[model samples]
Structures are given as structure tokens and as C-alpha cells.
Target: MATASMADKAKAKADTLIDEAEIASSASAGDVQAELENLRRDIAALTQTLASFGSGKIKEAGMRASEIGAEAADASVQYAENARSSFLSAEQDLEAHIRNKPLQAIAIAAGVGFLAALLSRR
Candidate 1:
């Protein structure tokens, strides 16, 4: 009878330990689920932040490109104006030279025409 009683007590103790272990494991599972939810929310917020940052960077790049294009256009216009001024100055100088020496200008023109006719024959 003593041995039977000891065996029954050991079985009851084992059952109690199993119940405690189950309760602890359930508590740990709930904590893990809550952590997973928090992680999901953090990831969502990070993605939104990165998307906004990328959008802002894209807009900034586009504005910079537009500014560069405008600068290039302005430079081209300035260069064209400079070229026109240079050409007009050269034309006026040539006209003044011709007016100052009409006989010499006629002689030079005849010489250029003779050279052109000679080259065409070849």
C-alpha cells in the first residue's frame, strides 16, 4: 500500500508540471504574436517614409534638369548674339575699306574673278 500511494503522488506531480509548462508556452506564443504585429507596423511605416523620400528626390532632380536646360538655352542665345555682332563689325570694316580705295578694290575683284575662271578650266 505504501508503494502504491507513492506512485499515485508521483503521477499527480507530473500532471501538474505538464499543466504549468503548457500555460507558460501559451503565454510565450501570445508575446511572439504581439511582437510580430509590431514588426509589421514598423515595416509599413518605414516603407512609407522611403517612398516619400524617393518622390521628393525625383522632383528635385527634375527641377535641377529644368534649370540646367534653361541655363543652356540662355548661353546659346548669348553666343548667337555675339556671333552676329562680330559678323556685322567685319562687314562694316570691309565696306569702309572698299569705300576708301575704290580703284584698288576693283583691281582685287578682277584678279579674284580671273583666278576662279582659271581654276574652273582644270
Candidate 2:
């Protein structure tokens, strides 16, 4: 009779422990779900803010790039005009020099040809 009473007491203790464990698991699941919801809300808010800022930044950058492109085109036109002027001046000088020293120019040309031939052979 004493053994039977002890067995009943052990079974009651086991049932109580199982009930406490189930309650604790339920509470933990509720906490995890709440945390997930809060995190989702935070991510959505941040995504909206970043999208707004990115659009403004893209517009500003496009305007800046357009301005820079216009400036570069103007500079290129001016450089081409300067290069044309310099080339014409050099051509005129060379013409005058060749007219003044025809024989000397011929000798220089022959020397240059000889040097080119030697380099090509190597």
C-alpha cells in the first residue's frame, strides 16, 4: 500500500512539470512573433526613407552631369580652334624655311631616310 501511494505522487509531479513546460513554450513563441512584427515595421519605414532620398540624389546628379557635359563640349570646340591656328602657323614657317634653304632641306631629308632604313632593318 505504501508503494502504491509513492507511485501516485511521482505521477502527479511529472504531470505538473509537463504543464509548466508547455506554458513556457507558448510564452516564448508569442515573444518571438512580436519581435518579428516589430522588425518588419522598422524595415518598411527605413526602406521608404531611403527610396525618397535616393530619388532626390539621382535628380541632382543628373543635373550636375548635364552641366559638366555642356562645359566639356565648349572646351573641346575652343581647343580644336586653337590647334588649327597653331598648325597653320607651323606650316607657314616650314614653307618659308624650305624656300630659304632648299639644298640644306634636301640633305636633311636624305639623312632622315637613311636613318629610317637602318631602323627598319634592325
Candidate 3:
């Protein structure tokens, strides 16, 4: 009769422990779900902020590229005009030299022609 009482007491204690474990698990699950919701909201806000920053950076980069392109085009036009002026000035100098020394210019031209013919033969 005493053994039977001891077994009944043990079974009641086991049932009490199981019930407490289940209650604790339910509370922890609620806390975990709330934390998940908070994390999701935080992630969404970060995504929006990053997107705004990216858009602004893209606009800034495009404007900078346009300005650089315009500068390059202007520089190219100026360089072409400078090259034309230099070519015309060199032509005028050559004409003046030939007028001042016709015999020397003819001798130089004949020597250049002879050198060109010799190089072409080889």
C-alpha cells in the first residue's frame, strides 16, 4: 500500500512539470514572433533609405559625365583650330623661304627626289 502511494505521487509531479514546460514554450514562441516582426520593419526601412541614396548618386554621376563630355568636345574643337592655324603658318614660312632662295630650294628638292627614288628601289 505504501508503494502504490509513492508511485501516484511521482506521476502527479511528472504531469506538473510537463504542464509548466508547455506554458513556458508558448510564451517564448510569442516573444520570438514579436521580435521577427520588428526585424522585418527595420529591414524595410533600411532598404528604402539605401534606394534613395542610390538614386541620388546615379543622378549626380550622370550630371558629372555630361559635364566632362561637354568639356572634351570643346577641347577637341579648340585643338582642331590650333592645328589649322599652325599648318597655315608653316605653309607661309615655306613659301617665303623658297622665294628668298630659289636655287637652294631647287637643289634641296632634287636631293629629296633622289633619296626617295633610292629608298623605293630597295
Candidate 4:
């Protein structure tokens, strides 16, 4: 009787160990699958955020380029106006000098023209 009871107890213990092993393996597999799913979701979110940031930066750069172009055009117009004013002032000064010394201006002009003609023949 003692021998039979000992055998039965050993068999029961073996069965319990097998059940525990199966449960542990299934739980580990399920945990691994859940972790993988979470990783995939995080990667997808990161990709979306990066795409949005890139487009925003591109738009900002385009706006900056436009602003620079407009500033350059305004500066060009200002330079043109300054040059025109300077030319007009020079013309007025020359005209005043010529009127004040008409006889001397005519003699200087005749001499310059004679020189030009002589040089052109060479």
C-alpha cells in the first residue's frame, strides 16, 4: 500500500509540472507579440511627425527666399533713383558753367574738335 501511494503522488507531481511549463510558454509568446505591436505603432508615429516637420521647414525656407528677393529689388530701385538724381545735378552744374563762360567754352570746343579730327586720321 505504501508503494502504490508513493507512485501515485509522483505521477501527480509530474502532471502539474507539465501544465505549468505549457502556461509559461504561452504567456511568454503573448508578451513578445504585444511588445512588437507597440514598437510598430511608435515607429509609425515617428515617421508621421518627421514628414510634417520636413514640409514645414521647406515652406519656411521658401518664404525666407521670397522676402530676400523683395528686399533686393527695393534696394535696386533706391540705387537707380540715387544715380538719376546725381546725373541731373551734374547736368545742371555743367549748363551753368557753360553759360557763364560762353566765349572760352567755344574756343575750348573748337580746339578739342580739331584734335579729334587729326587723331582720327591716324
The best-first sequence of candidates by lDDT reads: 3, 1, 2, 4
lDDT, candidate 1, 3-98, per-residue tens: 999999999999999999998877877798999999999999999999999999999999999999999999999999999999999999999999
Q: Of the candidates shown, which would achieve the greatest TM-score relative to the real structure? A: 1
Which run of 10 residues does model 2 get worst, by summed lDDT? 23-32
If both were scored by lDDT, which would come out higher, candidate 1 or candidate 2? 1
Return the TM-score for each candidate structure.
0.70, 0.52, 0.68, 0.66
lDDT of 2 by residue, 19-45 (tens): 999988778777989999999999999
Candidate 3 global CA lDDT score: 0.98
Model 1 spans with C-alpha error above 4 angstroms = 1-28
lDDT of 4 by residue, 34-117 (tens): 999999999999999999999999999999999999999999999999999999999999889899999988999999999999
TM-score of 4: 0.66
User: How many times do residue backbones clash in model 2?
Assistant: 0
Instruction: Give lDDT: candidate 4, residue 11.
Output: 94
Tell me the TM-score of model 1.
Answer: 0.70
lDDT head-to-head 2 vs 3, winner: 3
Residue range 30-87, candidate 3, lDDT tens digits: 7989999999999999999999999999999999999999999999999999999999
Itemize residue pairs with steric clashes in candidate 1. none
lDDT of 3 at 82: 100
lDDT comparison, 3 vs 4, better candidate: 3
Please give the CA lDDT of all the candidate structures.
0.98, 0.97, 0.98, 0.96
